[model samples]
Target chain A: MFLPGRRLSLVLGTALAVGAFAWFFASGERNIPDTEGGLDGNGQAGVFAAAAGAALVSGLVLSSLTNALRLPGKPLEIGLDGLNGATYLQALSGLVAEVSRSWRRQIQQYFSG
Target chain B: MAVLVSDYFIPAIFALVLFSLWFAGRDRVEREAHQRAVGISMTALGIANLAVQVINSVYFRPRPFVQYELDLLFYRPTDSSFPANPAALTFAIATGVWGGNRRVGAALYALAVLYGLSRVYAGVFYPSDILAGAAIGVVVALLVSKLFLLLEPLPTIVLRLARRLYLA
Candidate 1:
């Protein structure tokens, strides 16, 4: 079984996404909003939302194809599920549960004592 | 932003994507099963986000601070900020992590805050939009994550189909 802290791929993913976003800004490429919008066909919100939607669709389609090819094999698949990612929610949940457990134990001890 | 440093769109989206990646990356289950779970969960989130976007296009709304010239950290998009689809997508990814992967959820939550604050700062999106989007995303993620687990029997059926089709 892979150790929780041993996972580095998730950290990489977080870094990549953040780096990409920052790069977009730091690159300083002036985004001249194309007046002639394509899919959105209206304003800034439409365009941004459309872009986000496109990203989602494209990512899904690509992921399916990757799966068919077994690109990541089993390890990669786990990573994609969002469960394998080395995030802090697990620790927090553990901490919360631990606190509750400890609190309960304390109360039980008090009553027993 | 009128909200805070954490209330931005870019940071939120970034957090979402990263959290999803991180959560899905930490499976203790069999590799193939884990992979399939991640793939399905991500695809669901992606589709939900996309579908919501299309709906938004048809149902256009306005931004919160569009009327006033405000100093901000990011560029604002012109669209109805209600039902923040991006936030919803992130939340879905976060819930999918659940007990199976906590790191991913934390990352996603962090990203949610960033995305929400960024939108407000950019002078696009109302608090309502961010709230709705985040709530929806969380609900969807929870539902879809369980759905993936339920589909455990699918791989066998799919394999049988592949054999019949001679694609195996």
Candidate 2:
């Protein structure tokens, strides 16, 4: 028996640790340069910083708006269960009919206009 | 350690995406939705990365290794350093998943942060670069996820195909 939850948690924990260690040590490196002029010596760090901040703020706002609206969630089920040739053909035909109906409606609207 | 953080971490980030996909696949009910979310998120990430590239072209930032003599663990890139590409992609994927699954999303976000910080540690990118990348990624993910909901038929078609192929 394999425990996916436990394994995933372990992996996530390790990744976080590695990332933390890197950030901590990287900050202390002597070769690192001053942030006064930005990384490229072109003073673009300010611009990048502003853009990054804007993006974060916008993302948060959008996420909250969507959540508050109580948007319907989609299903994410994926597996190879209950599929056979008959069902495949049935689905295919249904799809074709749906496409044909949509096209016919568009054509009718175009000609009537 | 520097080499591991800078060079090896790249593959690890990719592995994280794969793991995320697999984890989503395990969801018997929401697998298709999760897959759709992943697709939309990746598409958004791709577009954002292209946008970042355009920005980088306008503003060229030199890598830390290029400015100072440091023991670089990886090959020095001649690209713009203001917005890190890897950080952008990882964060985009993480944020996209987060919209669908909170637990996994949180984990992925943590990984994205780690990846961003590691790039700085590796001396290939500046902290600002990582920050910009992450911001772009998150915004794109949020916007794309919302936009994708309007195109519900697209995912329905994909789900139908997956079902036909016995892939649920």
Candidate 3:
């Protein structure tokens, strides 16, 4: 639920991913022996081609999640009709109240550390 | 004074960033403009990445460290290397996503550049591969974003085509 600046997210995500890839490769243990001396032309080609396929599927999955069950804040649903200052302020205040009620402790933990 | 920034690490870092952007592009977009801009841009670059990779199926360009036996601190790509797909995708997504909120755009660009740097520092890809790929990505994304802007309020034409193409 953390919404970092998009740039930070991209950087952190890339760092995390590269680190994870290293971890996986180091721990995979399956190809180490065969690949140590270096994969032959065809073997290397196969490994990358296979990995590209996996990357494609993974990319698709990241963009298309169903938001039906997500925490609601549908901007489209909240059109400007009757959306004046009082009602909007009330709504925001209510949101703060609800969050404080549920996630106050988590927020405290996040900052206090 | 080029102490590091060898071939292998740079490309590896770029690859990592590309993968991350692809991951973000797939997430549920709160705003359609941001979503479509990022989505089409990254996906296209990603596909371009795949195409370059296919060429690697034959190219097998050696890493600089490997050629010089420098033993840099990074993992080597098993596949052939040319036209670094990862670098291409990272810059492409950054430019594509730049049309978003100003804060968001600046952040994405900075992140993309960092990712690019990490690749060179990692000793994974050649400078040329990274540069060329990044340039292509940025140019294409700019064009694509412009087209999306011109076609906003996504008409029946786009939605219908998207559906028929199974992209929607």
The number of the candidate with the highest TM-score is: 2
| Model 3, TM vs. native | 0.47
Query: DockQ: which candidate is best?
Result: 2
Cα lDDT tens digits for candidate 1, B1-168 = 422332233434543443344223323343334334445446556766876787688887766667667765544566566677656765665565443446655765786677666666566667778788877777766666667668867755754443222222
Tell me the lDDT of model 1 at B27. Answer: 31
TM-score of each prediction: 0.50, 0.57, 0.47
**Residue B81, candidate 1: C-alpha displacement in angstroms:** 2.0
- Give the winner by DockQ: 1 or 2: 2
True contacts kept of each: 0.03, 0.24, 0.00
Note the DockQ of each predicted structure. 0.03, 0.11, 0.04
**Predicted complex 1: CAPRI docking category:** incorrect
Q: Candidate 2 chain A — worst ten consecutive residues by lDDT sum?
A: A77-86
Q: Give the CA lDDT, 0 to 100, for residue B34 in model 2.
A: 70
Clashes of each: 42, 9, 21
i-RMS, each model, one decimal: 14.8, 10.5, 13.1
TM-score of chain B of each: 0.65, 0.85, 0.63
* Models ranked on DockQ: 2, 3, 1
Cα lDDT tens digits for candidate 1, A38-71 = 2221243344556665765564455444443333
